[model samples]
Target: MTTFYSHLKRSALIILMLNSFCAFLQKAHEITYVVGCFENGTTETLLEFDSDEVFYVDFEKGEVEYTGPYMPGFDPSQLFQDLQIYKNALRNSKACKAIVAYGTIMEKQPSEEKDPPESILYTAEEVDKGVENSLICFVNHFYPPLIKVTWTKNGQPVSEGVSLSRYYPNQDQTFHQFSTLTFTPTETDIYSCTVEHMALDRPQTRIWEPDFHHQHFELDVFCSVGLILGLLGIVAGTFLIVKTL
Candidate 1:
C-alpha cells in the first residue's frame, strides 16, 4: 500500500498492491510507502513493513536512514540506491501534482462514509492529591486521518508535558490516536481534552476531576464492613468455646 500526501493541497493518494508469493504462502503482510511533497520543494519519503518503519529518506541530512532490520534477502544499500532513483524521477516529474489535483476534486464530492471519533479522558493511575500523574485522551474510529487534540487545565490551555501518538489504523480502516498530559493531581483542579475533526459538527470535549470524597467514602465503607465481619467471627468463636467447655 502506497499513500502519498500533499499537505499544501490537503489530499491523499492511495495505491494498493499485493505480492502473489506472500499470498500463496498464506502470510498476511503489508508494505507502506509514503511520499509527502510540500510546496517549499521539500519532500518526505518513508517505507514501512508490517506497520513498522523500515527506513526513511532524510532530505535535510542528504542520507537514507535504516530504522529497522530489512526482510530476508533484502539489501539496505540496494534499497537506498533504488529510493534515490525514485526520488530523482519524482523531482523532475509533474505526476504528483496532477494526482493531488485529482484528489482535491474528488474530496469536494462528499459521500456518506464519515466516521466521527469517540473520545475518552481518564487518569493513568488512581487519583492521589499532590501526586504526579498522567491524563490520557484516546480518540478512535475516526476517518480521513486528520484531527486536532488539545488539553486544558482549569479552563486554560496547557502546552507543556503534552505528547501525541501517531495515527494507528484500526481493523475497519478507521484510525485511532492518543494524546497525553502530565500534571500533579489536585482536588480543586479540573482538566479537559478537546477533539476537532471534519466529521463532527463541533468540537467534543471530555472533562475529568478528582473526587476524593467519593473515594474516601467507598474506602470507609469497605473497612467498616471488614471490621464488622471480624467482630462477628470473634463472637461466634467465643460462644462455641464456652458451649464446648
Candidate 2:
C-alpha cells in the first residue's frame, strides 16, 4: 500500500512539471513573431497594438488547433503612431534649448517635459536687453547626425550668423543636439528659428514676435537722454571758453 501511494505521488509530480513546461513553450512562441515584425513582416506588430490588442497562434491539441477570437475593427498602422510618440517626447523636453531664444515653449507631448531628455539645464533668466538673448528654438530634424540652423526674418532665410553646438545625450539614451539662429530683429519684423534635425518626426518650429522678443524701451530711452545731456554739456563748454578768452 505504501509503494502504491509513493507511485501515485511521483506521477502527480511529473504531470505538474509537464504542465509547467508546456505553458512555458506556449508563451515563447506567442511573442516571438513580434521581434522583427516592423514594416514588411507582421501587420499587427508589438508597438502597433495597445494592451489586450494582441494576437497569437497555437496549434498543439490534435489535428489542427486554432486560438484567439480575432479582435473586431481594424486599427491604423503603428509606424505613424510610433513616430508621433517620439516626436512628442522630444518636444516636451522643455530643454530651454528646444524653444526659440525669445519665444515661449511650443506644443509637445510629455516625454520631453522639463526633466532630463538631457538634464536640468542651467535655468535661463528673463531676457535682459544688451546683455545676451538666450536662444530658444525647436530643432528641425534633418538627418541622423547633421542638421541646419538658420534665422528667418519675416519669412526669409538667413545664413552665416547661426551657431551649432555638439549633441548631448539624454537620460533616455537619446541625443540632445542643439543649433542656434541669431538675428537682431526689429519691432516691424518677425523672427523665427528654423531647424531641420534628424530625430524629429517632422519639422519642428518656434516663432518669436515683437512682444516675446523682450525689447526694452526703457533702456533705449535712457541711452537717448544721456546722449542729449552730453551734447548740451559740450555746447555749454564751447560757449563758456569762447566768452572767457
Candidate 3:
C-alpha cells in the first residue's frame, strides 16, 4: 500500500523508489517485476510478484533460476525497450511533471489507509414459509466512508426491497455501513450481498442460503428439547424423593 516515494541518491531513496515503482506497475497496470538485494549472506526482496514467471540470474554460479510458468520463445530483452518508452511517457505525464516541478523527487506521501469492510449477510428475524423476511447486509470497520452495496437473489440483481444506511464513524476512526434486502425467501432462494470500495481490489460478497437458516432452526429446536426433557426428569426425581421421605 506504500505509494509516493522520493529519491535522495542514497540507499534508502533507492529502496523507496524501487518499492513504489513495483507497486505502481502491479496495481495500476498488470505488469509485474521484483528487485532483490543479497549482501553478506542476507537476501531481501522488497517486492513480491504473484502468479508470474520469474527469471533470475545467479552471479556466483553464472546461471539462471526459474520457478513458475515461462515462455521460452518470448524474448525478454524487448522489455528493456518497452520500459524506456514507458519511463519517458510517465515523465511527460501531467501528474509526474507536476510532482517534479514542485522541487521534490516525488509527490505527497501516500495515505495510511484502512481496508474495506467485513461484510455478513443474515436474516433479521426468524424466516417463515410464505412470510416476508428481511435480510441484513452488515458491513463494518471500513475507512473513507464511501462504499457501494448491492443485493442479489438467485443470481439476479435485487432492488425493490433494498435499503442503504448512511456511513457512520466507529470508535477506531473507521466507518461502517449497512444494507438490507427484504424478500419472501423460499426453500430454493439464495441471497447475496456485494460490497465495493476503493480499498478493495475486488468487490466482497457474502451469500445466504435458505437451508442455512433451516439448519440453525433445527439445532435450536434440538437444544430446546434436550433442555425441557432434563428439566422434567429433575422435577419427577424431586417429587419421588419427597413422597418417599
TM-scores for all candidates?
0.66, 0.31, 0.47
Clashing pairs in 3: none
- For model 2, residues 140-192, the per-residue Cα lDDT tens digits are 22222234556676788755566665432222323346555544434576666
Q: Least lDDT summed over 10 consecutive residues: which range in candidate 1?
A: 13-22
Q: Pick the candidate with the highest TM-score.
A: 1
Which 10-residue window of candidate 2 scores lowest in summed lDDT? 12-21
Q: For residues 33-133, could you state the per-residue lDDT of candidate 3 as single tens digits?
A: 33222112222121123424344333344333444344577545443434443333333333433433343334345333555789888889987766898
**Candidate 1 residue-wise lDDT, 1-245, digit = tens:** 32322333333323222212234377777766555443234455566677676776665666667777657898766766654644653553355556556665766753435679999998899988898999999999987677899989899999999999766555465678999999998789999999999889999999999999999999999999999999999999999999999
**Residue-pair clash count for candidate 3:** 0
Candidate 1, residue 3: the lDDT equals 32
Residue pairs with backbone overlap in model 1: none
Q: Runs in model 3 with CA error above 4 Å?
A: 1-112, 212-245
Local distance difference test scores for all models: 0.72, 0.37, 0.59
User: How much is 24 displaced in model 3, in angstroms?
Assistant: 54
Stretches > 4 Å off in candidate 1: 1-102, 105-113
